[model samples]
Target: MSKPSYSKGLVGVIAGESAICTVGTGQGLNYRGYNVNDLAEHSTFEEVSHLLLYGHLPNKRQLEQYIRRLANFRQLSTAMRAVLEQLPGSSHPMDIMRTAASVMGSFEPEDENPNNEKQRNNQWECGDRLIAIFGPALLYWYQYHKNGTKIETRTGPNDTVAQNFVKLLLQTDNPDPNMVRAVDVSLILYAEHDFAASTFGAIVTTSTLSDVYSSVCTAIGTLRGPLHGGANEAAYRLISQFKTPDEAEQGLLKLLKEKKIVMGFGHRVYRKGDPRSPIVRDWARKLSEIINTPYAKNLYAVAERMEQVMMREKKMFTNLDFYASIVYHFCHIPTDFFTPVFVIARTSGWVSHIIEQRQDNKLMRPISIYTGPDPAKTPYVPIDKRLERSKL
Candidate 1:
């Protein structure tokens, strides 16, 4: 009866409402009304996860109890360990994360509750369990397949998520305090962004009344794409190719001339700039200074040169992933494991969105304006009479 309006990629579409985190809100990013700067400056990953899950920052006693609870949940079940052992080292780490989330769901199944009350509560616990165990699960697979070491998942009862992750990955009881803080701040910064691609994917799955694990698995799959969570890995690969800042400038200039799309340079929502970038960029610089190796120093320089070139050429600013790769590099993390780290941190946000979706249930179905052959002209033909279309 009337021409239907269409917005490609759903750009500028208000898909839903959320109060979880605000991006480009003039005062900078906030989680549950707390500024990201304050959270990054002062809060641990455990505290931020608590804020995302329980809707408030924890007091000292509450934080201690929460930490203990998460610690207690860190141990993987026998089946989980077996599954991790079977996964080959050739598998992508993000695939490992996806498989681990699905496997955890099987071992700890959520009962289907029509009322959703029991299921919702179970999801909260499931979220906490996954947050606690994801690092252990991932590193266990990594070490076992890499060199036949069945690494322990639990580093300490009191260790924060960042500490446990670093300790386990590095296989050291004593990790660099600066490295630990960098990881902690990265986790906080990456913990949530309102309706990001992966979060929205999780929300879409949740709208179908799926289990929390399935929803998180959906999120993981969505994040595995290069345009989303994989950007850091790609960005790191780009930075690693250059040995000097001047070389980096020339290489990046060539890339721009070739009309290549650089990863981790801009954002869809933050036209002004990504606030999260500078915070992690500072960490990258700090860690580079501490590492002081030629590679570390050179990588930081190359990254900075690339940032400057991107800004000068396209007026685009670096997003969180560009410099995050540098931070992870200084921490001795493998390039491929970069996005898996993203999964571990963003699990808190995924679970929060799942919980919120359950609170306000909807099918999330949107109509599309179809463009096809007219039904009257292209009536259903009998199979015997159908003609094959010509190749383009």
Candidate 2:
């Protein structure tokens, strides 16, 4: 037998590759057989989510009913809103999202019904709870501090999450359809990737037969780090530090000389190009035209130019985070709230992966290659002359 092997990330383990379609590959992503692109282009977020959890895209009639169910679910219970209000406005966006997810669990915990419709139904409710409450949880805390007014997210039209979110957040019934479309496709594109670290963390939690809420909570905590979903927020912050392409290029050269990463430049996957980049870049370009901000236009140009320089200097292309930063900014996402918005879109992908992992379950436990001393003998110290561990 071969000697036991150890790898830190299990990065290429191919834990389970779905026959599901993909986008970076030119084909649209389908959960089992239905396309998420088709759903985003033609169907509602509710319908797409239902397809993932239920194993088939809904028919027209089924979709209609699904939309109504999601509409009802959009209203966060009074307690959830209250919880959001209690959180300090200064809390990290991920902290706020994870707290909302964990506390909402107390309001709607999944029932124990393995491999059955009831379990699926409960998971759907939990899914609805997340999609529904995210904006409210985010905005309630945001507006309360920014404008000192209590905001309500229950007030959007019966339509797509993208459309409804724009309407609710902007407090306008008439939002540009193209803007909504941009948001919809962004959700679709980020919806799933094969076992990113955060997805694996969700799988590990759910693999324990933990409730759906627990799994989601665990996933959000992991995603809050800079190496994962939080990278977009870091990317925006990095871009904002430079006022012009020349400045950014100079700063990046300095960082490279010091052997530091320029956030949003490289990816753990996609060696040559990230397929998702062009899609979001188009959206960012369109939104720059629509929002008509000089900074927005300048920022986009600077980022693209920087990407070109990095390719020449460091041989790295812009990844999803690069374009996602500018697009999300033009979408009215505050720099600090970038990752929270990511949590909103990525919840669909995260939960779907969690469900899929449990269906064909395995413990994700991995061995570590230890390099420390095998075992140092403990030395005795006088109790009367005790020293603190830090001092020692």
Candidate 3:
């Protein structure tokens, strides 16, 4: 062989196929052939989730039933609640999600036989149940630790997923309608991305015919990495450090001059620009208007200045996380919970990929180029005979 080629990080490599989402076409993102911008503008998170999971946008009747089904599945079992209460308060929310997911699987597992259709239906139900209750599970733990009380997680049947999440997190039944809409849009935008690192990790797990919860847990752990799903929290911390756009501009410029890494400006895909950024930026602006606070307006201005500076200086574009930070902040969500929120939205994509992987399953093993010395040339030494050639 002349040489074995490898793409580090699998950059621009086609590791597998997916019918769920298309990314970086320079046109925009699409979930199951529908444009993400359209979905974000016109569809609820539940609807987009249905599209991703079941492979089509539901009609009025279907959507009504789908929303009802998701609402019905939103309650956590007593065992699950007990498990959440036992986790340490200092644990990262992502870890909480990973543990919660694994715990849920233990409570309700798929059928043991892989060849049975019941197993597939069980997996699908598990996917829905997890997505439906993730917010409740996370918020229950959050409130128990923060307030020393167990907050009721079920808001009402009338509440949407985004609305319920905001309500439960803030411990209020009533929230700003505009904020609710902004959150719904954000969830839709984050719902699916084709073969994102976490999604790929889920696919790998599912390819081994593992349970859906195991796949989701694997994706959660993968997303917990700073490089992957934690960018929004990092971006929020950066923008929140400034008092005004001028201070933000100066601080950003200083960091840029010092060649420090910025977390949320660029993306691995979407070289021209992230198509989702503009849509989310608009929502962020609308949220800023709705909140109409000095801090909200200042933060929005800071984010804009950062975007402009990064583009002008680095020729980089704002990714979804940049504007998402502003939207989540205006909604009063904690920065630490940002990545966990990502896991909530992205569970749809993860479970969808898991189902897809199992439909045409194959182990995701890839070959590596060997660089070590030949085994024959290396002799194993017995513990008694081994001795150091030199002593320090």
Top of the candidates by TM-score: 1
The candidate 1 region of ten consecutive residues with least summed lDDT is 112-121
After the best TM-score superposition of candidate 2, give how far the Cα of residue 306 lies from its true spot, in angstroms: 0.9
Better of 1 and 2 by TM-score: 1
What lDDT would candidate 2 get against the real structure? 0.73
Model 1: residues with Cα > 4 Å off, grouped in runs = 1-3, 117-119, 387-392
Per-model TM-score versus the true fold: 0.96, 0.87, 0.96
lDDT tens digits, residues 1-392, model 3? 67688898999899877888889876578988999888888889989988888889999998888888888887888999899999999998988999889888898886556465224767778888889889989999999999998887777776788988999887787888888898898899899999999999998888777888888988998998878899999989998898888898899889989999887888898888898999999999988887788877878998999898889889999999989988998888999888988988999889888888877777899888898888999899899998778874
What are the per-residue Cα lDDT tens digits for candidate 2 across 221-272?
A: 8888988888888888888888988988898888889998788887776666
Worst 10 residues of 3 by lDDT: 110-119
- Pick by lDDT: which candidate is best? 1
Models sorted by TM-score, best on top: 1, 3, 2
Per-residue error at 242 for model 1, in Å? 1.3
- Candidate 2 backbone clash number: 0
Error of 3 at 366 (Å): 0.4
Residue 81 displacement in candidate 3 (angstroms): 1.2
lDDT of 1 by residue, 6-27 (tens): 8988888888888788877686
